[model samples]
Target: MEKTPLEDWIAYKIGIRPGSLSREAIEQYQLARIRQTVALAKEKSTFYREKLSGVNPIKIMDYVQFSKLPFTYPQDIKENPLRFVCVSPKDIDRIVTLQSSGTTGEPKRLFFTKEDQELTIDFFNHGMRNLVGPSDRVLILLPWQLPGSVGDLLRIGLKRLKACPLPYGIVQDPEAAIAAAVESGANAIVGIPTQVLGMARHRKGKELAGRIKSVLLSTDYVPQAICQVLKEQWGCKVFNHYGMTEMGLGGGVQCSDLLAYHLREADLYFEIVDPETGQLLPEGELGEIVFTTLTRQGMPLIRYRTGDVSRFIPENCPCGTILRSMEVVKQRISGKTILAETDFLITELDEVLFSINGILDYQSTLALTGGKDCLTIEVKTERKNKIDPVAMRQVLHTIPAIQQGLERGTLEVIVGESCEFMPISKGTAKRMILDTREQQQRPSGIQHS
Candidate 1:
């Protein structure tokens, strides 16, 4: 009899469940798996074979040749999409494309075979088991849902869990979502940080408090203070999960520590390399995380570059999962949001606030003020007593990019809750520096106090 997909995945990968191999054994398994994937890509896919014409997968034993093969940027996929399609159109079972919130231009298209879908279901099923039990009712409170992507996959996983599914998204306004949660008797909430908290504006669902047992925050980083309020008000645990459309949604959680995510090793091999140099870095060192997917067939990625900057911690998780953890730190949280010849890097701004001594917690949104060139920053602080904008401006003025944007009357600073910072979303929040700026540029952008 053929082994079920779930059975095969558990047996194939190590450290995910019982009978799994150790990291050393998983490495050996990966070598064979990588070779198989490369051959499949070269034989069937023209895009990779042409780029990898003279390249041998085994000969790519080091990082230099590996990166030299070709970096698969989102634009490349958008331009000549068929380049990345590994199988025939008929062979494709489902197509999951995304308009990237990437700092750069255009969105990319991604595909999954019937097999790839099965594998994703298996991986998320195993991963979710760690975060939730059978008695949970999950409220997917993300504000936006891109058609034919993550929300559907999550629904598949939820079905397998036999947990009640509470559909929540941009379709439901914050007030509507709060009413849904109250009506559905949902025990756990899952989604972006903004939408979950957005519901707090309604102020009537405080009675739904004890029903929410846990909050699964994804697609962003959860600030520390936001998590505190979630636990205090909801009387539940906040589990932060980080995933990317490129990475097949296989990643770890930061429930035990502050905001952190770990790469799922059983199904893929994780490496940290110096972003500029591509040289592998040791643990506890910050670098660009690169991934090589093992079991994916419809669309397999080798040495894929995820732009996130993170460093790994060496100890075991206190949650007892034995999974290694990675934390985002000291990197550019924002991107080139250049308006009027001046570009403000998100990284510099985040480092400025995060490095401060007195700040307990914070959330920030970026906006373009007055005109195409004008920029405004809206920041919210949890500290009640001591918050100063002038001091913050002095620190910002030193940076040439920010100062020019300011001197031109293009930059404005406002302090208070974000117009979108509602209480209806989940725990962990995704606050890339560009998101704030992009939201501000909208015609009906944030409304201030």
Candidate 2:
């Protein structure tokens, strides 16, 4: 019955955040909480009990000792999910689950207690408070699949925001969804970028552009071009959010892409490390992002290696928010290409190309012959036939590094599927970079300790 660390931090004297303190104070407090967490999990949770049979958490002051316990991956829970439960079903308040599926294999299981769900709502509400005010109405456009948590809690938070939420899990036709949002008299829209982009390009949303206030792009990777087109046609601000069911609604934005995300740090500790070494990488190093939840009663990921690769900003947000800043990752590490000579981080390529407004949507794949790698780039455009090949190539091929790599045949750009892109997978849709490295590496991996 001990109070959760997250609840304590949020309900602290300021009733704002533990992050309001100076950097030195926050780290000192964090280390103390880490000690408390390790002790609590080890004492109450059998999984962590076996994990720390001998080592003392006090001795392992930082992440090094924390990670040494074992790499707690999704598969460990999937194989023995019931064993992961620290409490019985009678004590459990709520349960949330997701597929623990691996690549071309059986899906794994995920669970959440009521505490976990509320924390998720808190962050989602905190994130939404940025876009909405008292007068707005929201239309949530989600896949509405079995693990309905994504749209579920978002609806709850929107309700808490004093906004009307019309949750639509069915969008069999993207074009029709566009028309519905226009006619629903809703002021705001939230859905995947792919489906929303299809609507934005359609003539209907363009016709009803003046009525909307903000368009939220969620549950997928958003191409900048789609954001631009939506902003232009819909005449509303297009906002991007990064979150997952396991982590709760984790991240939100700061008006401009240049400003890194205002991370919900008190709930989760954000660490960007050398992807290979697991050593804490310095700020600005594009490293793998691993997380530890300070207070998740259901399924606390202690040093859980989230398969995404991103970097951390060494300072607080410029918008006067005390929450830490993280560059919501542009590329996942699994998408990188390691040829016989050079390794290409596709995220850097995305930064260069997505900044240009000419292209609408793109998918990058790595083709390997022995050790050589050629990139197959597919682009979706509204005006594909009208595009200037020479002028377009000059703009695309002129980028100093990408062009050099293209000349060496290590990089190739080819466009495919010029119209709207259908959903590829259940979770967030990556740019579809086919890295034929091991066929095992994904944005999130299923490694068991």
Q: What would the TM-scores of all predictions be?
A: 0.74, 0.78
Error of 1 at 13 (Å): 3.6
lDDT of 1 by residue, 53-151 (tens): 887878756444554555544456677666777788887887755655544555566787888777666666656655565667777765326543566
Which numbered prediction scores highest in lDDT against the true structure? 2
Worst 10 residues of 2 by lDDT: 1-10
Model 1: what TM-score? 0.74
Predictions in order: lDDT: 0.60, 0.62
Model 2 residue pairs with clashes: 100-107, 100-108, 101-107, 101-108
Candidate 2 C-alpha lDDT tens digits along 106-183: 444556777777877776665676677665778888753444377777777777768788787645565677667767
What lDDT does candidate 1 reach at residue 142?
50
For TM-score, the strongest prediction is: 2
Compute the lDDT of residue 267 as modeled in candidate 2. Answer: 70
